[model samples]
Target: MSFQGYLKTIKEKTGKGPEDFQALATEKGFVRDGQLQVKATEVTNWLKADFELGHGHAMAIYALLKGLKDQHSQ
Candidate 1:
Protein backbone atom coordinates (compact mmCIF):
# COMPACT_ATOMS: atom_id res chain seq x y z
CA MET A 1 0.00 0.00 0.00
CA SER A 2 0.99 3.61 -0.40
CA PHE A 3 2.07 5.68 2.62
CA GLN A 4 -1.21 7.55 2.70
CA GLY A 5 -3.10 4.33 2.29
CA TYR A 6 -1.38 2.93 5.38
CA LEU A 7 -2.32 6.04 7.31
CA LYS A 8 -5.93 5.81 6.16
CA THR A 9 -6.19 2.20 7.19
CA ILE A 10 -4.56 2.90 10.53
CA LYS A 11 -6.99 5.69 11.24
CA GLU A 12 -9.92 3.52 10.22
CA LYS A 13 -8.81 0.76 12.58
CA THR A 14 -7.69 2.93 15.51
CA GLY A 15 -9.95 5.96 15.18
CA LYS A 16 -6.80 8.01 15.45
CA GLY A 17 -5.01 10.27 13.03
CA PRO A 18 -1.32 11.11 12.99
CA GLU A 19 -1.76 13.95 15.44
CA ASP A 20 -3.44 11.68 17.94
CA PHE A 21 -0.66 9.16 17.66
CA GLN A 22 1.87 11.92 18.10
CA ALA A 23 0.21 12.88 21.34
CA LEU A 24 0.24 9.29 22.46
CA ALA A 25 3.88 8.95 21.45
CA THR A 26 4.71 12.04 23.44
CA GLU A 27 2.96 10.58 26.45
CA LYS A 28 5.01 7.43 26.03
CA GLY A 29 8.24 9.42 25.77
CA PHE A 30 8.83 8.04 22.31
CA VAL A 31 8.67 11.60 21.14
CA ARG A 32 9.98 14.76 22.78
CA ASP A 33 9.76 18.33 21.69
CA GLY A 34 8.31 17.23 18.36
CA GLN A 35 11.20 14.86 17.80
CA LEU A 36 11.51 11.13 18.04
CA GLN A 37 13.56 10.18 21.11
CA VAL A 38 13.77 6.44 20.67
CA LYS A 39 14.55 3.83 18.10
CA ALA A 40 11.97 2.84 15.51
CA THR A 41 11.71 -0.60 17.02
CA GLU A 42 10.60 0.73 20.38
CA VAL A 43 7.97 2.94 18.83
CA THR A 44 6.79 0.17 16.53
CA ASN A 45 6.63 -2.29 19.40
CA TRP A 46 4.46 0.03 21.43
CA LEU A 47 2.20 0.63 18.47
CA LYS A 48 1.90 -3.03 17.71
CA ALA A 49 1.21 -4.10 21.28
CA ASP A 50 -1.16 -1.31 22.21
CA PHE A 51 -3.01 -0.71 18.99
CA GLU A 52 -2.71 -4.19 17.56
CA LEU A 53 -1.23 -2.63 14.46
CA GLY A 54 0.75 -4.66 11.99
CA HIS A 55 4.35 -3.68 11.23
CA GLY A 56 3.54 -1.60 8.17
CA HIS A 57 0.79 0.42 9.83
CA ALA A 58 2.89 0.86 12.94
CA MET A 59 5.78 2.07 10.81
CA ALA A 60 3.49 4.56 9.13
CA ILE A 61 2.71 6.04 12.52
CA TYR A 62 6.39 5.87 13.39
CA ALA A 63 7.19 7.85 10.29
CA LEU A 64 4.68 10.47 11.28
CA LEU A 65 6.01 10.64 14.81
CA LYS A 66 9.56 10.83 13.56
CA GLY A 67 8.69 13.53 11.06
CA LEU A 68 9.63 11.22 8.23
CA LYS A 69 6.12 11.26 6.80
CA ASP A 70 3.06 13.45 6.93
CA GLN A 71 -0.63 12.65 6.98
CA HIS A 72 -1.49 14.21 3.61
CA SER A 73 1.58 13.02 1.76
CA GLN A 74 1.56 10.01 -0.56
Candidate 2:
Protein backbone atom coordinates (compact mmCIF):
# COMPACT_ATOMS: atom_id res chain seq x y z
CA MET A 1 0.00 0.00 0.00
CA SER A 2 0.97 3.59 -0.49
CA PHE A 3 2.10 5.70 2.45
CA GLN A 4 -1.16 7.60 2.50
CA GLY A 5 -3.07 4.34 2.30
CA TYR A 6 -1.30 3.10 5.38
CA LEU A 7 -1.96 6.36 7.16
CA LYS A 8 -5.60 6.24 6.20
CA THR A 9 -5.91 2.68 7.42
CA ILE A 10 -4.16 3.52 10.66
CA LYS A 11 -6.48 6.43 11.26
CA GLU A 12 -9.47 4.29 10.46
CA LYS A 13 -8.37 1.66 12.93
CA THR A 14 -7.12 3.92 15.70
CA GLY A 15 -9.26 7.01 15.16
CA LYS A 16 -6.04 8.99 15.50
CA GLY A 17 -4.11 11.07 13.00
CA PRO A 18 -0.49 12.13 12.84
CA GLU A 19 -1.02 15.01 15.24
CA ASP A 20 -2.71 12.75 17.74
CA PHE A 21 0.09 10.22 17.47
CA GLN A 22 2.61 12.99 17.88
CA ALA A 23 0.91 14.12 21.05
CA LEU A 24 0.79 10.60 22.38
CA ALA A 25 4.41 10.03 21.51
CA THR A 26 5.35 13.19 23.30
CA GLU A 27 3.43 12.06 26.35
CA LYS A 28 5.23 8.71 26.22
CA GLY A 29 8.60 10.44 25.93
CA PHE A 30 9.31 8.95 22.55
CA VAL A 31 9.55 12.42 21.11
CA ARG A 32 10.97 15.71 22.37
CA ASP A 33 10.50 19.09 20.76
CA GLY A 34 8.89 17.47 17.73
CA GLN A 35 11.84 15.17 17.27
CA LEU A 36 11.98 11.50 17.91
CA GLN A 37 14.17 10.68 20.89
CA VAL A 38 13.86 6.92 20.72
CA LYS A 39 15.08 4.31 18.30
CA ALA A 40 12.83 3.07 15.48
CA THR A 41 12.70 -0.30 17.16
CA GLU A 42 11.40 1.26 20.33
CA VAL A 43 8.69 3.10 18.43
CA THR A 44 7.74 0.01 16.48
CA ASN A 45 7.65 -2.08 19.64
CA TRP A 46 5.33 0.39 21.29
CA LEU A 47 3.09 0.44 18.25
CA LYS A 48 3.07 -3.33 18.12
CA ALA A 49 2.23 -3.78 21.77
CA ASP A 50 -0.23 -0.97 22.17
CA PHE A 51 -1.76 -0.64 18.72
CA GLU A 52 -1.33 -4.16 17.38
CA LEU A 53 0.36 -2.80 14.28
CA GLY A 54 2.68 -4.78 12.05
CA HIS A 55 6.24 -3.74 11.33
CA GLY A 56 5.55 -1.91 8.07
CA HIS A 57 2.55 -0.08 9.46
CA ALA A 58 4.45 0.92 12.57
CA MET A 59 7.35 2.12 10.45
CA ALA A 60 5.01 4.47 8.60
CA ILE A 61 4.25 6.25 11.88
CA TYR A 62 7.90 6.13 12.79
CA ALA A 63 8.74 7.82 9.50
CA LEU A 64 6.21 10.52 10.22
CA LEU A 65 7.65 11.06 13.67
CA LYS A 66 11.09 11.38 12.16
CA GLY A 67 9.96 14.26 9.93
CA LEU A 68 9.58 12.37 6.68
CA LYS A 69 6.42 14.26 5.79
CA ASP A 70 7.11 14.56 2.07
CA GLN A 71 6.37 10.93 1.50
CA HIS A 72 3.40 10.99 3.86
CA SER A 73 1.74 13.86 2.04
CA GLN A 74 0.46 11.66 -0.76
Candidate 3:
Protein backbone atom coordinates (compact mmCIF):
# COMPACT_ATOMS: atom_id res chain seq x y z
CA MET A 1 0.00 0.00 0.00
CA SER A 2 0.93 3.65 -0.44
CA PHE A 3 2.18 5.86 2.36
CA GLN A 4 -1.01 7.78 2.66
CA GLY A 5 -2.88 4.52 2.53
CA TYR A 6 -0.84 3.25 5.45
CA LEU A 7 -1.43 6.47 7.35
CA LYS A 8 -5.16 6.37 6.69
CA THR A 9 -5.28 2.75 7.67
CA ILE A 10 -3.44 3.46 10.91
CA LYS A 11 -5.76 6.32 11.66
CA GLU A 12 -8.71 4.05 11.03
CA LYS A 13 -7.24 1.38 13.25
CA THR A 14 -5.82 3.52 16.03
CA GLY A 15 -8.03 6.58 15.86
CA LYS A 16 -5.08 8.98 15.71
CA GLY A 17 -3.14 11.06 13.24
CA PRO A 18 0.50 11.11 12.18
CA GLU A 19 1.25 14.17 14.23
CA ASP A 20 -0.35 12.48 17.19
CA PHE A 21 2.05 9.58 17.13
CA GLN A 22 4.93 11.80 16.20
CA ALA A 23 4.31 13.81 19.29
CA LEU A 24 4.02 10.69 21.38
CA ALA A 25 7.22 9.31 19.94
CA THR A 26 9.02 12.55 20.54
CA GLU A 27 7.98 12.46 24.15
CA LYS A 28 9.38 8.95 24.32
CA GLY A 29 12.79 9.83 22.79
CA PHE A 30 12.32 7.64 19.73
CA VAL A 31 13.63 10.40 17.51
CA ARG A 32 16.64 12.61 17.09
CA ASP A 33 16.71 15.76 14.98
CA GLY A 34 13.57 14.70 13.14
CA GLN A 35 15.06 11.40 12.09
CA LEU A 36 14.66 7.86 13.29
CA GLN A 37 17.11 5.04 12.65
CA VAL A 38 16.76 3.59 9.16
CA LYS A 39 16.84 -0.21 9.59
CA ALA A 40 13.34 -0.86 8.29
CA THR A 41 12.78 -4.22 9.94
CA GLU A 42 14.05 -2.94 13.26
CA VAL A 43 11.72 0.02 13.03
CA THR A 44 8.72 -2.19 12.42
CA ASN A 45 9.59 -4.35 15.39
CA TRP A 46 10.05 -1.29 17.57
CA LEU A 47 6.68 0.08 16.57
CA LYS A 48 4.91 -3.19 17.26
CA ALA A 49 6.59 -3.74 20.62
CA ASP A 50 7.05 -0.25 21.98
CA PHE A 51 4.26 1.78 20.47
CA GLU A 52 1.75 -0.99 20.06
CA LEU A 53 1.53 -0.19 16.39
CA GLY A 54 0.43 -2.84 13.94
CA HIS A 55 1.67 -3.51 10.45
CA GLY A 56 -0.11 -0.60 8.82
CA HIS A 57 1.19 2.00 11.27
CA ALA A 58 4.76 0.73 11.07
CA MET A 59 4.51 0.79 7.30
CA ALA A 60 3.45 4.40 7.44
CA ILE A 61 6.90 5.36 8.73
CA TYR A 62 8.50 3.20 6.09
CA ALA A 63 6.43 4.88 3.44
CA LEU A 64 7.58 8.21 4.76
CA LEU A 65 11.20 7.15 4.42
CA LYS A 66 10.61 5.87 0.89
CA GLY A 67 9.04 9.21 -0.03
CA LEU A 68 5.65 7.61 -0.37
CA LYS A 69 3.95 9.24 2.58
CA ASP A 70 3.72 12.79 3.91
CA GLN A 71 6.27 14.98 2.23
CA HIS A 72 6.32 17.58 4.92
CA SER A 73 8.59 17.12 7.88
CA GLN A 74 8.66 19.01 11.14
Number of clashes recorded per candidate: 0, 0, 0
In candidate 3, which residue ranges exceed 4 Å CA deviation? 37-42, 50-52, 62-74
Tens-place lDDT digits, model 2, residues 49-70? 9998889989999999999863
lDDT of 1 by residue, 1-74 (tens): 99989988998999999889989988988788888999999988998999999998988888888788788888
For candidate 2, the 10 contiguous residues with the lowest summed lDDT are 65-74
Candidate 2: pairs in clash = none
Encode model 3's per-residue lDDT on 9-65: one tens digit a residue.
Answer: 777867877777666655655655677545667667867886688877787765564
The model with the greatest TM-score is 1
TM-scores vs. true structure, each candidate: 0.95, 0.92, 0.60
Candidate 1 to truth, TM: 0.95
Report the Cα lDDT for residue 51, model 2.
93
In terms of lDDT, model 3 sits at 0.65
